[model samples]
Target: MFLGMAVFLVGCAKGGSSLNTVPVKGRVTLDGAPLPGATVTFSPKTPEGRTAAGMTNENGEFVLTTIRAGDGAVPGEYGVAITKPVATAGPVDDPRARGGALTPEQMAQIREQAKTKGGAEGGSAIPKKYTSPTTSGLTATVKRGEKNEFTFDLKSQ
Candidate 1:
């Protein structure tokens, strides 16, 4: 009975090890400077599998991982999106802060207030296009058994 259990466990381990993944790492730079605290996402182009994502550290370095930490990503072409929101100076009121659905009038009032308060103050530092995978114009092909390292030079303008 012990032998059978051991064989089953080994089989399970082997099955788990069969998942295909490849290492992906990269650096992000905005206007020639390292961009920290930015989120980098890799959405598979062909629906081949799950998406892989990572956040840039202080040095603007990141490693793609999916399913498991640092396990890398499935080999395929992917659309990349990178974003970093600017910091706000003070707290802003949220329409749903009361813990219920907001009425249309309340939403309009908040929008008007935000416009008057300067909506761009706490907006994203990265270009709006770069925040969407479809519009970022960034693509990477993760090849199997190969080191997939990339450097993204983004422009704020």
Candidate 2:
């Protein structure tokens, strides 16, 4: 009886099975700078392929777990679509005057930096796509059980 129970536990573990799923992890950077909080939508190469997707973290890093459906990204080509970053609004000072610092010039400088970084109202610093050159080096083909690294370089259109 004990032997049978042990065998059942081992079967449950399912070790050494190729079906054991691993994750695809990497960071998204632009001009050698981290693009934190960027939305990375990865659609499978085909309806028969495994569908997995995730969003980048504050470090512009993301991990997509393989679904049990079709083979994870068939060992072939793939298309990557990285949406333009949406800038986040900085913390606004309360009108209640809880702050005890920050001169008028300093505040102005802060606003200016934010605007230069993205926009006064916070917008994408890069265009949605390279309207001219299609070779933007934005796509990548992930290998099975392998972690792929992808870097994107952007310039003003």
Candidate 3:
């Protein structure tokens, strides 16, 4: 599970400046089981907020970031979308299949895919409706002062 977040922090987010982001973390579950490797996106309901995203670990836990790694998101209402693409054979496959330490070969493959597969397109294990914020039927409100933790329980049918 830690591996998934580590990869995302290294591959997706780069650090430099800061924003008025709060601490937002959450878990994603599909049909009562952890939905790992899924990308959890918080699409801003207003122009005042920016989009924030995080990748779920094997336990489906995630910490959101907007401007930098783990920086969280601006306080506002957001429509949520969760998507996990079908895996192609590689070291960077599904989190369930990827366990234990990473070999140098695995690291190499990860770096390459981090560059090439940034978009991460394919069919999803979950229903297609969960892939889009408009149709996800999920929404969250990130408050300003406290820890913003959420759990999304999605159904297959």
Candidate 4:
């Protein structure tokens, strides 16, 4: 009976999940409106911490997933960085886009055009500073056994 109980207990313990992540959810807004399709990242402030990430829906709502789908994150201090990549219209009229053989001079011109197309700013909808952890000016503290909801408001200007 003692041997049977030990085996049963070990089986029960092994069958359970080892990870203990907390529920973390949040919403993102730009200038007081829902910012859809924006990616939200939570970087651990500590060296031995795990990061969590999620993307906003049409209503700017998001559910963080650390391990599995909607599994949430491990409780800790995190630096948040939100970003939205702007879509650029393809160079429809550019001959390089077509399946045509180009001369050496044409290739050089095409490279020059690509270099000057977006300029230095690159095309993010939000300020470039907000895309990095150190410059974003956002932070959060995820706790255990409680509501870990957060809301971030961003400005265009």
Candidate 5:
């Protein structure tokens, strides 16, 4: 009885946290122009694993990866957020240049600072609403056996 109970508990512990990811890719454009170097994120509407994200290349193309590079995300509906902050100021101190590796939290803070006070003397090319999943009005459904390609055409005005 004791061994059976132990096995049951172990099975329960390993039951639900498996990652079943699907490939997701997309393009982002603003005012008909490619928005390069933008950060695109997919936050699962229900409780999934960690969020998946990708950075757009120069052609404004991105591929989503959650656990491993290019490994993709779990199948689900996601709320999307995109942010691209173009710097308007001159050279500023970067933590990386000082040989200190910045944590994700620190990197996020830097991005926020740039959005609020960096671009063109504190201006942003992309609308602020697109920076948050709650406000971006972007959604995508990643299906199990479907090509999850999406396009987001944004307006600066």
Candidate 6:
């Protein structure tokens, strides 16, 4: 009888929570290739909207789970942004150095710019557009209890 009661209590506890989650998954790419480490954000477009974001993994894939509370990115539209990473530094003797192409003046300018703030000032990189593109021009719908998939083909605006 004690075993039966224990089983009943466990089952009851499990049944109390609601399964209101809808899985959001997708792949990010640029120029027809996977873009790993791209930061993907899904922002709601309504008053009830809440922001949810995830970064692409090594395989350029991302998944947003347990998206409960605050409407699931609305069942209609959203704004998506993909921020790609930039590379820096290289070997002094590297062949790609342009055969000591950057003259002292140019090198000094580069260093001076790198020390500035907000983008070039702080050695920080900026997207070609100087800002992330808005996916308002794109649409991603969310369905209840089902996974909504999308493939974001990012391009420079």
TM-score of each: 0.68, 0.47, 0.70, 0.68, 0.69, 0.52
Q: What is the lDDT ranking, best to worst? A: 3, 5, 1, 4, 6, 2
User: How well does candidate 2 match the true structure in TM-score terms?
Assistant: 0.47
Prediction RMSDs, each to the true structure: 11.5, 14.5, 10.2, 13.9, 6.9, 15.0
Report the Cα lDDT for residue 1, model 4.
Answer: 100
Better of 4 and 6 by lDDT: 4
Q: Which ten residues in a row have the lowest lDDT in candidate 2?
A: 94-103
Instruction: In model 1, state the lDDT of residue 9.
Output: 85
Write model 6 residue lDDT over 28-114, tens digit each, in one string: 776677877554556555655434444566777866422322222334456565544354544123111222233334434333332
Relative to the unseen true structure, what is the C-alpha lDDT of residue 138 in candidate 5, on a scale of 0 to 100?
A: 89
Per-candidate total of colliding backbone pairs: 0, 0, 0, 0, 0, 3
Off by over 4 Å in 2: 1-21, 66-76, 85-125, 130-137
* TM-score (C-alpha, index-matched) for candidate 5: 0.69
Higher-ranked by TM-score: 4 or 6: 4
* TM-score of decoy 6: 0.52
Query: Which runs in model 6 stand beyond 4 Å of their true positions?
Result: 1-19, 65-76, 87-136
5 versus 6: better lDDT goes to? 5
Say which candidate scores most in TM-score: 3
Kindly list the per-residue Cα lDDT of model 3 for residues 42-146, writing each as its tens digit: 888897677777778989898876655677888899988777767765645433243233344543433233323232465567877887677788999999998
Off by over 4 Å in 4: 1-17, 89-122
Model 4 C-alpha lDDT per residue in residues 36-101, reported as the tens digit of each score: 866677778898666666667779987776555566778899888776657565422422223233
Better of 1 and 2 by lDDT: 1
Query: Which of the two candidates, 2 or 4, achieves a greater lDDT against the reference?
Result: 4
In terms of lDDT, the poorest run of 10 residues in model 5 is: 111-120
Model 2, residue pairs in steric clash: none
Q: Candidate 5's residue-wise lDDT over 1-157, tens digit each?
A: 9999999988765543357778888999999999987767777789744477777777898887665566667888887888766566664443333333345664455345433422334555698888767778888888999989999998888
